[model samples]
Target chain A: MTTDAAVELAGVTKRFGDVVALDRVDLRVPSGVIFGFLGPNGAGKTTTIRLLTGLARPTSGEVRVLGREVTSAGFEVSSRVGYLPDVPAFYEWMTGEEYLAFVASLFGLESSVAKKRAGVLLEAAGLAGVRTRIGGYSRGMKQRLGIAQALMNAPALLVLDEPTSALDPIGRKEVLDMIEALAGKATVFFSTHILSDAERVCDEVAILDRGRVVANASVDEIRSRAGRKVALEVAGDVERVERAVAAAAWCRGVTRVGARIEAAVSDPGSAQRDVPAIVAAAGAGLVRFETVEPTLEDVFVELVERAS
Target chain B: MRGFRPFFLKELREIARTWRIWVLPSIVVVFALTGPVLAKVMPEILRSMSSEQLGGAVISLPEPTWKDAYAQWVKNLTQIVTFALVIMLGGTVASEVRSGTAIMVLTKPVSRPAFVLAKAAANAVLVTATTLLGAAATWAVTLAVFGEAPLRPIVQPTAAWLAWALFLVAVMTLASVLVQSPSGAAGVGIGVYAAISIASLSRWAVEHTPAGLIGAPGALLAGDRPPLSWPLAATALIAAAALAGAAVLFARKEL
Candidate 1:
């Protein structure tokens, strides 16, 4: 594990009964980076979170958090990692303050410090006024409380499993804001199927498919690899333009329907180079021309599909 | 100790919120309060039955004493209250894992052994309190009915009973640690109990062996055959060892 990396998994494998949940997976998340774990359901996102947080042991391979081996130094690593499960549950009998206080004490916080921290965290998570029983909390409020508890120790790494999956749009935005705010100070390894949520907050991402990480790179790197897609709506001879686009050197594939033409291009740079020539050669009158950037969603679907 | 304090408090709170605390105590208290009254009144009711309704039943009845009431209380406890407790808290440890609440705790700096120990301590305290309440209630009623007819002889038996209760709870903790669900834990616990009982039934020297620790309430307060000091001692040691085993298992188990 590098000193700069908050979490590192080297060829980790985990199995549940007959199912291989995670297989030879490797991930390295730098300290103070918002790392997105993007995968569809059952793509081993939660399994990775459990392994990183020391909630579950890997069937084989090594896991390190905060530069310490997980199984052997779990206590040391866990003391520095705060985790929120996909569905966080608190002792229903407790109030928000009480629950956070209990979590703080588990981290060996002094009573005065724990209370002060809990108060500040509850406020930060937008749960300040919700002093009632946790059982009475709405799903969103519970999620907010989950965030509050996860950040209780101000851990070096914060692992949130599908933090925004079950939330409404507003709730999702709130969690994203909390995650974004933690950047530059704490390493955030957030797992989610919500690509928009990842795009909204993550600095780096790993797209997992079928118990393996298919793509691990920064948001920019993934977008760069996916390339850009250009959609052009032309007024004339769509079939002629399609034939012309098929022979264009800069384009990968082109499809047309009635007046609309969409092309997967080699590069956005080349789109400017080759699009006009193709349009002029076919003599098509273009109504609209637009360039679309690849999003985290596209990258996720592509990786999952390619892996399968 | 910090984690144990908070976790134990949390466990107690769970017992309070759920039906576990009220269900068994209600049954035991009801049985305790009604035992003397039922014993006192049952004979008269039997005598009042018409000959045809009685179907040629004998008319004369034995006087209802505190001994009879105590007997009734013990019978009800052995049959119902203890069983309710076992069924209710059977999955205390398993529920946390199944519900993923254990994730919240294990991710903290607290040790897994502390987690298991806290749960065991909380369950032990709660069970002991309720059982003692039932015992005291029974004793009070029996005293009022039978004029305190030398109840000291029962104290040793009651102590032995408490020991077995501790043993039962230790086994439940072991079951809870081993299984992932409450129903699974209860099944394992009951199976452990049955295996022990069947073993105890054998007339071999092993029957009287400390392995008799497996038969809890039955082995505790059976007869003038006093609680075996060696067996009781052995069971306590084994129960402690089992609890330690559970702690070790939970420490290594994936949440």
Candidate 2:
């Protein structure tokens, strides 16, 4: 484990009977940053989170959290790690405040400290003054309380699995904001298939696909490495323009939508020079021709497609 | 064990919030109150029915005693209380696991043994309280109706029943850990109870197995001092084994 890494997994292969959930998966989450585990559904993201949280053992390798081997350290290391499952379930009979207090006590916090911390976390989770039973909470409210409970110990590493998967846009924003607020205070390793959520808050991301990590880099690096997409809006037959652009060796893929043509280009410099001439040769009046920055979604799709 | 106190308190709070605290004790108390009243009235009701059937010919009946009252209480416990215990605790661990609540708490600093032990302790405490309250109520009612049921017979039998209840809880706990569904756990618990009851008919099991513990109370009420030490010790050992087994299995279980 690196000195700065909050979680590290080396050659971790978790298999259930005949199916492999995670195969030789290696990942490192640095301290004090939001590391997004980005993958589509069934891409081993939750499996990775479970391994890191010590809820399940690896079939064949080592997992370390907060510099302690999870398999060997047991609850000692668990004390330093806070985890929220994909669907966080609580005692529905308990009021939100009571549940949080109960969690605080599990961490062996003093009574006064537990009370103060519960109050602060409740406010931070946007659950302040909500004394209703958890059974009465909305999906979003339950998620927020889940986060609050996970933070009761002020843990070194916070693991959240799809925290925003089922929330509304407003609720997603609320959870994302809470995750963002943890920057520099605790290392937040959250898993999500939502590219926009990761793009908005993640400093680093690991793209997992088919039980393996396809890419692990900073968000900016993935965006840059995915290269630029060129958008050409023309006032002629879009099919003619698309063919002209697609024939070019530098253009990776092209999609035509009515009067506009969007082409992913590997060599942006050459494509920039050639696209205009191709549009002219095709007898199309070009309305707009510009290079657009690649989104995390594009990188994710490209990596997953290529890996598959 | 770490986090036992908080977890145990949480279990207690859950019982109270879910109304198990009141409902279970109320069931026990109702049975207790009805025992002595039924014992005092049954003979008179039988005599009246016999006289009516015999065309007003007088019929005499043996007077009811405190033993009858205690016996009624024991019967109610073995039937109603046992059934209630199985139903109430069948899902104790299975529901938590199925709902993913176990994952939430198990990821914290709490050890698996502590979690299992705390739940067992909370349930034991509740059952003990209910048993004592029911016994006290029965004692007062029996004294009023039967003119002084000796404390020793009532208290001893009640203690034996309490031990058996704890043993059943332990069985349910182990079954809950072993099975995925609450119904399955209940089935296993009831199966174990039935097996014990059936096995008690064996000649060797009469004096050797923990099955004898459940029958000790009735034997004591019948003025037969059944040897209780071996069966009680065996029940304690088996209950401890079940709880310990649950903890060990849960520790290795993948949440």
Q: Kindly list the interface RMSD, in angstroms, of each predicted candidate in the order they appear.
A: 1.7, 0.8
- Per-candidate TM-scores read 0.92, 0.96
Error of model 2, residue B183, in angstroms: 1.5
Off by over 4 Å in 2: B48-60
**Model 1 misplaced stretches (Cα beyond 4 Å):** A267-270, A280-283, B50-52, B55-57, B202-207, B210-227
Tens digit per residue, CA lDDT, model 2, A1-308: 58668888899999999999999998888888899999989999888888887788999988988888888896778888888998999999988999988888888889999999999999998889987889999999999999999899998899999999999999999999999989889999999999999999999999999899999889999888786889989988778889989999998888888898999888889988998899899988889999899899989998999998
**TM-score of model 2's chain A:** 0.97
Candidate 1 lDDT by residue in tens digits, A6-75: 8899999999999999999999888889999988888999898888877788999988888888878857
CA displacement after TM-score superposition, residue B50 of candidate 1 (Å):
5.9
DockQ of 1: 0.70
Worst lDDT window (10 residues) for model 2 chain A?
Answer: A1-10
C-alpha lDDT of all candidate models, in order: 0.80, 0.89
